[model samples]
Target: MCDKNCSFDLSKRHLLKLSAGAVAFAAVGGLPSVSYAASLTKEERDAMTPDQVIKSLLDGNQRFIKGEGVEHDYLAQQRTSQQGQYPSAVILSCIDSRAPAEIVLDAGIGELFNSRVAGNVSNSDILGSMEFATAVAGAKVIMVMGHTKCGAVQGAIANVEMGNLTSLLDKIKSAVGKTKFDGERTPENYAFVDAVAKTNVQLTLDEIRKNSETIRDLETKGTIKLVGVMYDISNGKVELL
Candidate 1:
């Protein structure tokens, strides 16, 4: 019913139509149809509530623990975030090299605003940063994260003094005293050290609210949530406190 040339032309036309349809689908989806990958937009970030943001972080940590991290095209994410950032949370964490917040939480670039200090303690400057992150940058959650076996906690317990470090360790001393540990209340006891670390995170959370009325008002108004967490370096696990 059809000549060879006519049949070949019909097949070619059909293939072209299919290709066009695929392109149309990809365009509507905002990336190649085969792969959909992009950074969080302001609209997307705004759609999530503080609770949802926290849940997402918890889920991300679970994935990290399972070794099932989301495949991220870091280069693509970096390129997309240049326009603007819409981070969902601001994290205050220690400057320990092993306790990187992003890696532990499985957060991608532009997903969080991280402020790192030695003991994860809060000060006027840190409070100012939190205010800006929540009020100005639209972050919905503020997390004060501490880790187990923290050297800063050890320093506070041992009363180690070295130049400017002496003054910095003073801030953490309050937490060391506040921690109600019965046995071996010293850095030599790992349990006591970790207990102090947890207490420090709680103290930092309290200090943030006490120091920053802007952050306090935001939390009171239900615009943001403030929470604390502890990271265990022995096993990549984050415990919400």
Candidate 2:
């Protein structure tokens, strides 16, 4: 058996060389040997295509919804990632306590870069962060995810005018108008609220593409993928939109 330092070096080299085929196989449930708990290395992240990254996330969600998520070794992951992280995707999600992006997607540490905000809205800072995540850090996918029963979506629908929140909710108001709903368009109405939230995700995607030419060009060139998704808290399912 190798000594401590030798083992550590071996682990680092092994992690760094993790194959793309292993990740792709894991995405489709074709491999059980692939460890989701391992920190993603640059080689592993670089090997995945944008579509594969999205598919892997979806597969993770499937595991989550089924309550079959892989048991992670947090300490091992921490040790593995202490050197560096090479995440494949950057996700923008809500600040809601129940909708944490990593848990819902069954992703371990170092697998994703999460940027959360109220209503999953994008501003200059969030956009800048995403640009950095993709352009600088080599992430291949950007996902804007919104959830059902979001209070921000409710506030926008009700026109709640609190101090700073009023301005933040105002950003989502346009989605309220854009959402075609026949039922009661009130925060109390869960269906309408969810509809607005979904529209908000799409709007945020559009805004990011329009406001950030860097991201738009990367997407146009197929270097990265931009997607929108909705998380259903009631059912623990994430659906791509």
Candidate 3:
């Protein structure tokens, strides 16, 4: 019959005993010790330059391509980031099931601020979100990521019009006109689709700089960066454009 205080002490003692046993087992070479990296703290995120942040993401992608991604303890990260998050980059990528931004970039929880749409197109709402992510939340980079064999790019190229999706695809039509592909300019031609997707990424980045004075000012001051990227679905590689 233990009192409440005694029960608490016993629980603490039990945890300490388990921890000691685990450490001892590792010390004796009976078990391998594993430690997961924690989520980025405010100081760490603030200390990094914009280019450094982008390089880190690219390196992570390399690791992912090598099938050597870091094993994150997500529960620990979740608990550590319960109070706040300080992501260094905001990524605008396609909503394709095959191109998950975090997994492709080998990012863990609280490492990136990600926004996804069908064609990676941006509107006022997305602009506002970017403003919040950068101006308010202290993100240092804005990356627009497009992928090969995109259905949205195909739809936009085909002038697809269905219900509300018509207006969304209409926004991407400008890139179709801007793309200069010598080969067959059709959705069935995957090369043409990829070219249009690249053009769309560049156009979207240009639109971001043109539309958002806050982001443009940040870029002008060298406080942040605007980047364009294309992902290859066949090879799991990202090209920095």
Candidate 4:
């Protein structure tokens, strides 16, 4: 057999035609074969210790801060995760655009189960989802992440009311009492806002512990570990506890 670079005998061989797209990409590294690319063979989800899971998030945050990330295949990962997801961790975060759990953590599909709500509140449903993530979906760790300068935290702080938002903000009211800093408690109060964000995550963590029996059992047996973190949007780093 001739080498891959060997030319075929022109007089004896028939011409093999290539598609326009293929010919166009022939100058480059070769256009990706759609049929082959669509196949989801590399479904290896890495194993991570609970502590490693936490550290990985922090490292990813650092990458995000530096404007670097592992931006990868979207459709391929989605197709692979269509049937099942083996995420390494579960993140309960506030539904703030600036605080997106996946991008800030530099996570790819099937990497972490993200549970987002206003103030990252842990009601029965959120707890249930987290329970499913760890117990059923095989997530090794759970994270309650809250961000700085949060509108929800401010709304709760200011006691703003509109539609059902009253009730949603009410869930964050507990953090006000938890904010026992040496200064005032208002959004203008940067120290207070910062404290509120931290307290909110810690509070949500407690709520998760209090509300979910399944998660509690998992935590007790060390099958899963729970942690709280505050994401600073300005600097893009997670302060984990």
Best-fitting candidate, measured by lDDT?
Answer: 2
Clashing pairs in 1: none
What's the ranking of the predictions by TM-score, best on top? 2, 3, 1, 4
- lDDT against the true structure, each candidate: 0.80, 0.84, 0.82, 0.71
The C-alpha RMSD in Å for every predicted model, in order, reads 12.8, 7.6, 12.1, 12.9
- Candidate 1 global lDDT: 0.80
lDDT of 1 by residue, 1-241 (tens): 1222221111111111234444334334433212214566676566556876777677678778999776766787798889998788999999999999988887777889999999999888989888889999899899999999999999999999999989989999999999998899878899999999999999999989888899999999989999999999999999998
- lDDT by residue (tens digit), candidate 2, 1-241: 2222221111221233346565444444454444445677888777667876777788778879999887877887799989998888999999999999999888888889999989999999999999999999999999999999999999999999988999899899999999999999889999999999999999999999999999999999989999999999999999999
Candidate 3 clash pair list? none
lDDT of 2 at 200: 99
Quantify how close model 2 is to the true structure by its C-alpha RMSD in Å: 7.6
TM-scores of all candidate predictions against the true structure: 0.85, 0.88, 0.85, 0.79
Model 2: clashing residue pairs?
none
Worst 10 residues of 1 by lDDT: 7-16
Model 3, 98-160: lDDT tens digits are: 999999988888888999999999989999999999999999899999999999999999999
For model 2, give the 10-residue run with minimal summed lDDT. Answer: 4-13
User: How many pairs in model 1 have backbone atoms within 3 A of each other, for residues 3 or more apart or on separate chains, i.e. clashes?
Assistant: 0
Q: Supply candidate 3's per-residue lDDT for 48.
A: 57
